[model samples]
Target: MAVNQTQSSLVIPDNNASVSGNPGPWTEPTFTLAAKVRVGVTCCFFLIASCSNVAVLCSISGKRCKSHLRVLILSLSVADLLVTFLVMPLDSLWNVMVQWYAGELSCKVLNFGKLFAMYSAALVLVVISLDRHWAILYPLSFTSAGQRNRIMLWTAWITSLLLASPQLFLFRLRTAPGVNFTQCATHGSFTQHWQETAYNMFTFCTLFVTPLVVMIVCYTRILWEIGKQMKHKNELARSKNDLISKARLKTLKMTLVIVASFMVCWTPYYLLGLWYWFQPEMINQTPEYLNHSLFLFGLLHTCTDPLVYGLYTPSFKEDLRSWIRRISSILSRRAKNSKQLAISELNIKDLTSMEGPTSTAVTMQSVF
Candidate 1:
């Protein structure tokens, strides 16, 4: 999902890790500008995304943050956080070293994590959109925030893990006859050709296309519902008031922003993958820079959730501000206390100095 060779739609390293082994002359991979840029971008994103996703997790896990949308966001942030921590650093390493020195087990685990996080994030988005669709269009049927069952969240994680389990088997450290180091990759063979193609199609449709379709449909229906409700003069006051609530509108906007960011960040990687599936030759022809750039774009989505939600949702914004203020207060208090202690110490020193030998002698004599 990020920039891992295993996650790439091409399933083939554009240059370094050859699919069919050593074709003829084998030369060591040299570091290039694309590698440098990919490493730098990945490192930057790893820091930003890891911190933001963690902050979102902290913000939403609080008692005050109870809501269906917040719960969904909590789940989504978990997935993004996993991607940021588990997938990003290794992907960045692969981008730079252009070799997989890690053993077969490491390869399987890393690839599984990448696929699991990606699928889980996408599926969670679909679930959120569906929840919104149900809540917005049929207010009567939707459960209250406290009443919402966590079954769907559990199901998303389990389902994503089940779907991505193939990576454990398909991924292994592969080394060409003449190559010194092994790379984590699937075998590009006649037997495995169909398997790779089918898996790629499944991942693309499940993780990208289907979720996108679900989001679009849900959002469209939601808008239609809102518009229809607004037009009905005889609509129940409660319904009208619900629609007009600032919190509701903010939630909707936040949802749209999250969906839009996901689409923007992921679409290119999926589209490029789709193209590569049809035109395997293009894999060789596609510029390495473009491939790295697309992966970077996809990775950017991992960091954007908090920003999107914070900007559009007042509650999250307020929570963030409160968290910041609390931290500032603690720091300020510590500084003030330290300053007071310093002043007290200085005053004590001045008093002792002023007392001089006379005071010291009197005090010692009295004590004796």
Candidate 2:
């Protein structure tokens, strides 16, 4: 969440440009060092998020009966895919182009997509935290966990779409008065300065604050529950439910890690956005590369979620190993086949050369 939610967050509001007698041309976006850095870093994140999230989906997808945990993780993976496929690519392309070239329709659609992707990821994490909270506090009450989780996941996705739908209306192609530069932003859409600020703040609350509070509360209670469980460890050690209790605790720890990564990765970027909202002048004071870096840093959360998931998932690791071995086996067979073919070709060449010499000698003798 940047000062401007859409338009690549590159178009900082300038109140005086139209007020001036001679409005200068908008300085075009260049593929400078800042952009180069964004491209490189975002590409790395894209690959990581894409591969890791897809792997998570695949590893859990084949299970006949998914627990609420798996369902929430699957939903999270899908949300990460949205960020990986939509936000990362769009940001890279928009930065490289430096302006809106994909026309007004594309501008609206892509802006909507960016917001939707972000909202989905944040909301899914909220769902995951809430699910864990419910499971920990009321294990017996989770009679239909799958059905309940499905409903929550649906609600999260629909809410994400609804929250992000305004971007289509709020953003459009805004061209400079005398310049050919057009940006996908909310410049003309908002009549007053405060309206844009209100919108940004609203987005900030939805994208960061609300979700943060929910997760913090959920995880805090979970920690308290863990502490209580530790107090009864000796009793649980003698009970038949000991193994089940330990497994649940391990899963809770893993989910907390995923939540922690999301918070750690995005906290700084959103905090910067909050500061910029209060002090609009920071946009100018801040170096270009710093802005780019901060946004890319926030994107790191998308990659980290999958890494956390994969780390906790033993089945995913086993599947990965199997995949690696299968690929290596296929490569080795191809290499061996190629070597054999080369040897056979060499033998054919030798036979052809020897036949040529023998035929030449026979012709010479006939001529004599």
Candidate 3:
């Protein structure tokens, strides 16, 4: 999710604030070349994330039985799709416009939508990690996995909604004095600076810190369970245990890679946000380009999720390949048809030209 740190660069400094004087004649952000590049990059990531996640949805939906794995994949894809459709385009458009043109109502709703999508993306992965932990550690749990998965899905979505709801109350259209630039931010939401910082700290904890800890803990337990099983196996089962250990380790390694990438992508932005919330002066101290770069780097996580998950998932990878071939064939046929149609038009024009000459020759012969 985007933080106020991003808007700090765009926001005009308050004369009443305790920061450096005037930062001199505040200049509002414009549709600069950097903004244009951001829009283009965001668009590219949006398209990639949209297609991959949609493919994941379609592939899972087409299956005859909805296993827990498929269900988890569907949930992850849905979460990514939410980010692809909601966050990427909105952020890009906001950058291009350099201000919130939509009304205050739209601002509140979009802000809510953004945070909701962000929560869903992170929380669903937490759900998946928990599911994996349960399946591996307690294979014969009291509750059926299907039932448990449904419950977790409901909880993830409901929790995301509840957490993001505050955005509706916190964000509004704020216009600078004597300027037409109005932006959607939490500028006037809190009376005290500490209150605003407190709210941001709460969001940061819920959105990033808690989910991350849950996922890492879940996987850590899973890996321990795996190693324990290997250690306790009988000598007679050593050969089979080796195979199982190798396979499990390979899968878990990939899972850890996903967690690592998630951290790498989001950690910088969140850390920067944490710093800015405490040290408001750093808002001016941080470069605008650095903020943009980190925000986009965070957005890259949305694009990476599907690719990583799909590439490793045999079924999803096959579905993606089949889809690529299908799209390629369709385009090929359309292009071939267009070429043929053009040839026919050229031939018709040539015949029409010849018709005039032939008519003139016939007329001259008749005259003779």
Best by TM-score: 2
- After superposing candidate 3 on the true structure, give the runs of residues whose Cα lies further than 4 Å from its correct spot: 13-25, 64-66, 233-254, 343-368
What stretches of model 2 exceed 4 Å from their correct place? 1-9, 12-26, 64-66, 234-237, 356-368
Worst 10 residues of 2 by lDDT: 15-24
Per-residue alpha-carbon lDDT of model 3 for 1-368, expressed as tens digits?
24544556656644225333334567877776767777898899988888877876888897633476668778888988898898888888788778888899999998899899999988888887787777677766625888898899999999999999999998888887788888888877777777877788888988999989998899889888877877876742558656754654554565566666788999998988887776666766766677778888998987787777766667777787898899999999999999997886676557657788766555545535
Which stretch of 10 consecutive residues in model 1 shows the poorest summed lDDT?
1-10
Ranking by TM-score: 2, 3, 1
Name the regions of candidate 1 deviating beyond 4 angstroms. Answer: 1-27, 144-149, 188-192, 233-240, 243-246, 332-368
Q: Is candidate 1 or candidate 3 better by lDDT?
A: 3
lDDT per residue as tens, model 1, 1-368:
22234334223333223433444344555557877888898999999998888887877777665466667888888888888887788777776667777787988888888888888888888888777776676667655533453677778889999988887887777665665756677664225445566766877777788889999999999888878867995755666565545456567778888899999998887788777765555766778788778888988998888788667656667887898999999999999999997886676557568898667666555545
Which candidate gets the maximum lDDT versus the true structure?
2
Candidate 3 global TM-score: 0.86
Relative to the unseen true structure, what is the C-alpha lDDT of residue 166 in candidate 2, on a scale of 0 to 100?
A: 92
